[model samples]
Target: MSSSEVHLRSTIGGVSVEGQLHTLSVWFILALRLMMGLAFLQAGLSKLLGGEFNAAGYLANQPASNGSPLADLFVAMSEMPLFMEFVNVAVPWGQLCIGLGLLVGCLTRLAAFWGAFMMVLFYFGNWDVAHGYINGDFAYMLVFLSVAAFGAGRILGLDATIEQYDVGGQPLVERYPWTRYLLG
Candidate 1:
């Protein structure tokens, strides 16, 4: 009800007119982003370097291939040795991009989204055989999903700049509430 408060509430482009100092949540998000990014980067790099990487042999040995629906799909996909080689090379680069994006808080949501997708593939590929709740890959996917949902990048990332400037009063963004979640 004060003049100052009234002025503060006034806005130019249908955006909220308020500002607040950073809090602990911001730093926590940043840390989580960095760690998650690093994890992906490491996995990709390890696979590319051929440092004890053997997904083909491992997949062939999985019990899921014993007449399961997914077995055929997996076998067909894994049969292309060239495809596996491509993945082995591409995954490292994807990881590096994700790691840098997350660590720098640049395009954090996009990076997290891709990271989660990769984790999902890894989870399904291995968990089909484990057949239990004790899977590390599943947990990792959850972490990536969490990061994407929470929009960890905006806390201290380039995403903040985009949200504050580039996406002003966009109806497309309004319809997709999840974008707000990712933009933070």
Candidate 2:
């Protein structure tokens, strides 16, 4: 109810959810975006520059020790030479692209979606339930999802400008509503 707080309410599947956010909450949201961006960027760069980032041994071995349910699937993937080749390239490159997209706030939702997806696989792959089912991977997954849902890109990000770009005399988002899924 305070002037410095913003109220938010939504109804999903007939369930109403509501909350209040302090005006300064946007800064925290931006911080999450930047932090994840840096983490992923550094990871990708290290993998690409390491020149010995073979995933086969890790994929075939790590999951089993951790008792991951997908351990068998990972092992199978490692066995397939072609798939392993693709994985070697995709993992590092995907992280780099996702990092850049999030850092610059360009195609942020797309980046965040992929980031969340990668986290999902990592959550299963790492499969550490030592203290509990919750872990860093699971937390990162939520962070990615929250970034997408909050449209964090529009806050001091290129997405704000990209959305307002003129297209046939109309803002890009207004012209093509579907772009909302990718841009913000």
Candidate 3:
């Protein structure tokens, strides 16, 4: 109830929720955004610079060995020459674009969405349920979701400036309200 705290209330799926956030929560949220940004940026940079990254071997072997339920689908995908070609290029480039978007906080929600998607694939590919259903990939997927939900891009990010840019004499988001889904 302090003046510095933020009171939040909302309802989703007929369920009501309420909470309060400490002023310092913003800094932690910012930290999560920056941490994921840096990690992904570095990963993408190394993958691209490392040269000729291929997913065929991983697709054919890793998922099966890890006992993923999607192992058959992964193997089928690897056997497709055209699909493999696309995967070889898409994985690295997608990572690079996603990383850059997040690092700069431009098209952040879009980037986070893709990041979470990639994590979903990874979670299945790396499939280790021996310790439980949760793993690093699953955790990273949640982190990406949290970042998007909290609109972390607005915290020291380009999305804030982009959203405020004048479009037809009105702020971009104000003019096109739908952009709220993509930006902060």
Full ranking by lDDT? 2, 3, 1
**Local accuracy of candidate 2 as per-residue lDDT tens digits, 14-74:** 9999999998999999999988988899989999998967889988999998999999998
Backbone clashes per model, in order? 0, 0, 0
* lDDT leader: 2
Judged by whole-model lDDT over C-alpha atoms, candidate 2 comes out at: 0.93
User: By TM-score, highest first, what's the ranking?
Assistant: 2, 3, 1
Tell me the tens digit of each residue's lDDT in model 3 across 132-182: 999999999999898898898898899999999999999999999988888
Q: What are the lDDT scores of the predictions, listed in order?
A: 0.67, 0.93, 0.89
Cα lDDT of model 1 by residue, 1-184, tens digit: 4333222244678866654334545565667787898887776776667675545654555626443445656666667899877765556778888887887777777888888887776665665543665477777777777777667877767776666553456643455556665554
Clashing residue pairs in candidate 1, if any? none
Query: In candidate 2, residue 104 scores what lDDT?
Result: 92
In model 1, the runs with Cα more than 4 Å from the true position are: 1-23, 50-55, 62-69, 128-131, 165-184
